[model samples]
Target: MQAPTRTARTAGVLFLLTFVSAITGAALYAPLLTDPDYIIGPGADTRILLGAVCELVLIITNIGTAVVLFPVLRHHSETAAVGYFAARIVECTFIAVGILSILAVVTLRQTAGPDAAEYLPVARALVAVHGWTFLLGPGFVVGIGNGLLLAFLMYRSHLVPRPMALLGLIGGPLMSMSGVAVLFGAYGQSSIPSALATLPEIIWEASLGIYLTVVGFRRPRDAETTGTGAQESRAPRS
Candidate 1:
């Protein structure tokens, strides 16, 4: 078999970066963020520091996906490619804002001391900022950028299997809709329904990363034919 092309290798790295960042960031933030006492509790400093690190990774890799894929994707559709890249940038910006909010909470916790209760309101507000950023960045922004544009391009180009691409096609809109529902107070963000709504997208991303890493995309027809011809030429003849 032929070695993977530079484009394929780059795609693999980008996908893996997104996969790692998503999982690690969420893991670091979810439990602590969910706890009401997190801001006032012991180890709050360490937890917030970890959250900051994770968000930073997410911000960088989120934009990296668009940057790495643009060269190849643009060849297929320049308009869509640029749109995806821009959307990713927006997503990353919101994530960075969220990180700042988390840091603010940490700073307050450090200085408030015995008067932490007095500053609780401000901490909650900062947490709310992070929550809104999460909703907008991974929830809505991903729907437009990673979900719609990325999947559509892959589907159109036959870069990966159509069924795999369909996951993003279907999941993206659902996630975005769910995000809107949360914004409107349709359901709690941490509720079971919310989890179910987001599951497809989670699977879509995980599958995308694995597929790109292991399968490394489907080669164009002409390239496959050329590879086969070259192999046959190198075979021993009678």
Candidate 2:
């Protein structure tokens, strides 16, 4: 029997980061939307301040995790080498957007203080870009990109069990399309169609998190699932 590898472990950890960041990010938006009383008019209140801080953290951590995880997927995938790299490119976009988002809030403070409401339009654009690119964009990409790539490689190469491969296959497109919905700003409104569209995306991400953590943390059963992450070595032997 072959030993467990590092690939498994690395993917596992990446998976953990991916979902934890996602859930946190998604959860944060809820309070802001639900309770506008705290946000609409804010003094230097601790809770209000902390909420924004949490949002910034959520953006940073989520985007950061995405930036890191794509490479892990690329390193592991056998097909769609370009696609895997595209995933990285997409993630970098997310990071750029995340940074801009941080700057937007900081700038908001500066602007809101004086007669800088003129900058409101600029701030809105920046926040919109950040929202679409970093939070929603990468959120959509990571799940489908990695998940599909994993399934393809495992199925085509016979790396892992077929059931796992199937999950990747089914989940991948579902996730990718959901991500694309974000590109169109389907989540921008509170309408039923918009909510319905956004629901798939949230579910897609949540499912990805559950799948990766469950699969990643499991004890290695074969050389296919060894100690650290035997990415290529997991290919079946003749």
Candidate 3:
């Protein structure tokens, strides 16, 4: 039905948004991880710019995802619905981090007057906020939370292709674990272990994005419509 097509399109968009967001984070901040004291111009213009760009992408993507997710809920199983809502909440938090951190970055960039440590206050604050949000907040807290929900939801829902649902289930736990690794790495608790952790997070994003894209655009009718129709479909034979 038309609904399936529309839902599929939205799923594609979610994939696009998340994929781009990942790229932005990797490209921009990865450099900072290597060099803590690196500066662009006077007070680390390069770092601030990178941070802003990443956040900007996230802001736009989260907004897009939020728009599509409402329609998306209509098609999910109860457990899937729960997982979906949890992901939405996580997305919102990510957006909040993007916005707040961006503001902090811009504020420092503007106010800084060649004091090497000038940007540190704002940047550190923003980074600190980011540290909690992305690593502690989204990665560990929300990521794991949603991952578990999605995994459980996928297990319970019979509407999707078994393979696809199973894929989602598999990805969910991995994603949560990736978040944990990312958190540990971001906090600098363990060097090699933390570095190892990020690989999975990125992989989880890519893998999940790929699965959603494939399933969304295919326009295949899975348990979503079957379940929907059953609720609305009456006992005409009786």
Candidate 4:
């Protein structure tokens, strides 16, 4: 009913949408991601195109979350809020590039026809670009933005439970370190260790989304007390 409540609900929905869109998009792209010679083979053009659509949804929801939350977050700390917003923009930018790369692959597949073999290297290169963007965008930038900055704000502002926020505090750095390790070839991106490392962050975000959607933001203790005091002061004289 109120503005803050509406804002929280909108942001929460956006967060959940981001999760859905991202996962669905990645799954839909499996044909390309798993197959190196997909460009030359009978490509799942329609499926791949659908995947690109999901990713476009992801980009929208990703930026929407930041935009919806910025006003509330800035009330707590303007600089951190701005940083988080910027981070979301950067993350979405990477996602957009990745989407374009995949689209290019699809285009080549459709138009290249029998000569697809010649563009095999080019298609693979494009896939590689998408892979790197995934790592850098969702892998690294998400750690800094959603994991650290957003979590810290939620923790400090008492917008959500501290324990929930704590998950982000811990997970953010772990996710970033894991990204770095993957970057340095400590393990493959799809390895068990990488999945394990990503678990906490996944939980943090999922829980935050659920909580904000269901319970909405909690008013700070001081704000509650101040409101009560103001009400008492305005009471009629005995």
The candidate that achieves the highest TM-score relative to the unseen native structure: 4
Weakest ten-residue segment in model 4 by summed lDDT: 222-231
The regions of model 3 sitting more than 4 angstroms off are 1-3, 30-35, 38-47, 66-83, 114-122, 151-160, 174-208, 211-238
**Candidate 3 backbone collisions, by pair:** 159-223
- Residue 60, model 2: lDDT of 54
lDDT order of candidates, best first? 4, 1, 3, 2
CA RMSD, predictions in order: 5.5, 6.3, 5.4, 4.2
Model 4 Cα lDDT, one tens digit per residue, 1-238: 1238889889899999999999999999999989999988888989999999999999989989998998889988999999999999999999999999999999988899788899999999999999999999999899989999999998877778788999999998899889999999999889999999988999999999998899888765433464533443566767
lDDT of each: 0.78, 0.50, 0.53, 0.89
**Which lDDT tens digits does candidate 3 get at residues 1-238?**
2346555456556757766765676466644433444332334446546656676666566556545544544455554565566565666676577557655655555666576465565565665676566655445543443345543443443323445445545555555666665555544533565545444444544554555566553222344464533533454544
Please give the clash total of every predicted structure, in order. 0, 11, 1, 0
Q: What is the Å distance of residue 95 in model 3 from its true position?
A: 4.5
Model 1, residue 27: displacement in angstroms? 3.0
Per-prediction TM-score? 0.85, 0.59, 0.64, 0.91
Best by lDDT: 4
TM-score of 1: 0.85
Summarize candidate 1's per-residue lDDT along 71-93 as a digit string, tens digits. Answer: 87887789999999999999999
Stretches > 4 Å off in candidate 2: 1-3, 26-82, 134-136, 179-238
